[model samples]
Target: MTAIKPGLKLKSAVCSAEVMVIKAPAGASLTCGGAPMIGAKDDAPAGAALDPQAAGGCQVGKRYVNAEQSLEVLCTKAGEGSLAADGTALELKEAKKLPSSD
Candidate 1:
């Protein structure tokens, strides 16, 4: 687990998913595809495999957030991985309703 802060780009260890920290509390464990994420620039070891249980697909440009909303991440690259924080799956944030121009 590492300290999560805004503007930190993270890459999934098991997949090609990439995300940027939008808002995160200290000491948040960010994971993707059931594997811990690393710094974007960090090289992923060869032959890494994704966890079968966590193989949910990630969408590009989606904002995934935890239940408490204390942690939020913006997906930059798409891949077969679900975003999670502290072992809890992140849900997509609902879009704001637009005003009706009657």
Candidate 2:
């Protein structure tokens, strides 16, 4: 778990995925590929591998949010791992429907 704020960059410990925090609650536990995420400047452990169950992969340029919608992150680089918070998988945030102009 880490104290994350908007604009903080995090990288996956097991994969190449990277994200920028858009919104995050204090003490939020963020993970990628079933492993805790590290600061962008931090180094990953040697021989780290992706977890099979969390290998759904993340898409570049997509925003993923938690169930309560309190946490959100933007994928800056796509990778073979999925994003999660507190052991729950984060889902892609759907685009808001625009009002039809009459």
Candidate 3:
């Protein structure tokens, strides 16, 4: 996989999920719906099929990140697929807690 960089947009080859790179480490493999994500301007493979095991369903307007904090993606469209990096699933970024006024 090519080195992913911030501001790069990607689209799922198997589903409608779309994402923009927030932060990505060099040499990381980004995937959506169990298939390699392509450039945002590129079209999905005509006969591609979704992998059942990777169908965790992504949420629109959500941010996903890996445990290592080396990769981050912001979903632009929702789809029946989960985000991953090098075969490991990414988790939704937790919401930040608000500071107390007291």
Candidate 4:
């Protein structure tokens, strides 16, 4: 079953992420910090599930969406929580800028 999902991109320069497919219960949702996501369906895209607190806390879910396994998440940048080609996060204060050759 496929559905149109509207969500934010996850990535930055200093921090990075991986997409994976997890084995979780039917209706579980994966959360990083507090944001929720599903398995990235598009080729260049990006989900979630699994109880990190449980004893067998290996990172997997119905569609974990991480670098360890999934491919859709490749669309987002590594950090700063924005799309790879987006301008808002690319202009971060700590981000380095190349000097103009002129």
Candidate 5:
């Protein structure tokens, strides 16, 4: 068995305001938002609006669209993991032994 190490780390990287979300499954009849974007998933049927109290707020996999207005979306960290970034998995490092101080 092998233990995996951490990789590259980029702190709060400020990206410009051109934020984009690409939906999948493109077609000609639909409103084409230009190339590079595949478009919305028509295969994925229109989802049901969720109740906040029932769902305990929005989840990841469970599909739901925001139907409510003036909802205070308090963006909080659900959990945290080892902060890693793009790059090689770091060179396989060998553990070094220290000399006896005695």
Candidate 6:
């Protein structure tokens, strides 16, 4: 688990996915490709591969949020891995509906 904060950049250990933290709760564990994400400046371990079960693929420019919506991250780069928090897969945050000007 990492102490995440807004503006912190992270990269996947097993894929090319990268993200910036927008909002994160304390003690949240961010994962990509079923492996814990590492700091953007850190080097990934040797022989790391994408997890077949978590290969949902990440989309660039998308916002992913946890079930409680407390943890959110913006995808800075796309890759063949999905985002997850605390073992639960994060979902794409839907755009807010605007009121009609009738």
Best by TM-score: 6
| Residue 55 CA displacement from its true place in model 2, Å | 0.1
Off by over 4 Å in 1: 97-102
lDDT digits (tens) for residues 1-102 of candidate 1: 457899999999998899999999888989888888998888777777798888887899999999999999999999898888899999998878799989
Clashes of each: 0, 0, 0, 26, 2, 0
Q: How far is 79's C-alpha from truth in model 6 (Å)?
A: 0.7
The lDDT of model 3 is 0.89
lDDT of each: 0.89, 0.94, 0.89, 0.27, 0.18, 0.94
State the lDDT at 53 in candidate 4.
Answer: 31
lDDT of model 6 at residue 46? Answer: 86
Backbone clash total for model 1 is 0
Error of 1 at 100 (Å): 13
Model 5: which residue pairs collide?
23-39, 24-39
Provide C-alpha RMSD values for all models, in order: 2.8, 2.9, 2.8, 14.6, 19.7, 3.1
CA error at residue 90 for candidate 6, angstroms: 0.3
Q: lDDT tens digits, residues 1-102, model 5?
A: 011112211111111001111121122111111111111221212342222222232221222111221111111111111111121111112236689889
Q: List model 6 lDDT by residue over 13-33, tens digit each.
A: 999999999999888989999
| lDDT for each residue of candidate 3 in 1-102, tens digit (9 for 90 to 100) | 446899988889999899999999878888888899998778777888789999998999899999987889999999898889999999999878789989
Residue ranges of candidate 5 with Cα displaced over 4 Å: 1-80
Give candidate 5's TM-score. Answer: 0.15
Please give each candidate's TM-score. 0.88, 0.90, 0.89, 0.25, 0.15, 0.91
Candidate 3 clashing pairs, residues 3+ apart or interchain:
none
Ten-residue region with minimum lDDT total, candidate 1: 40-49
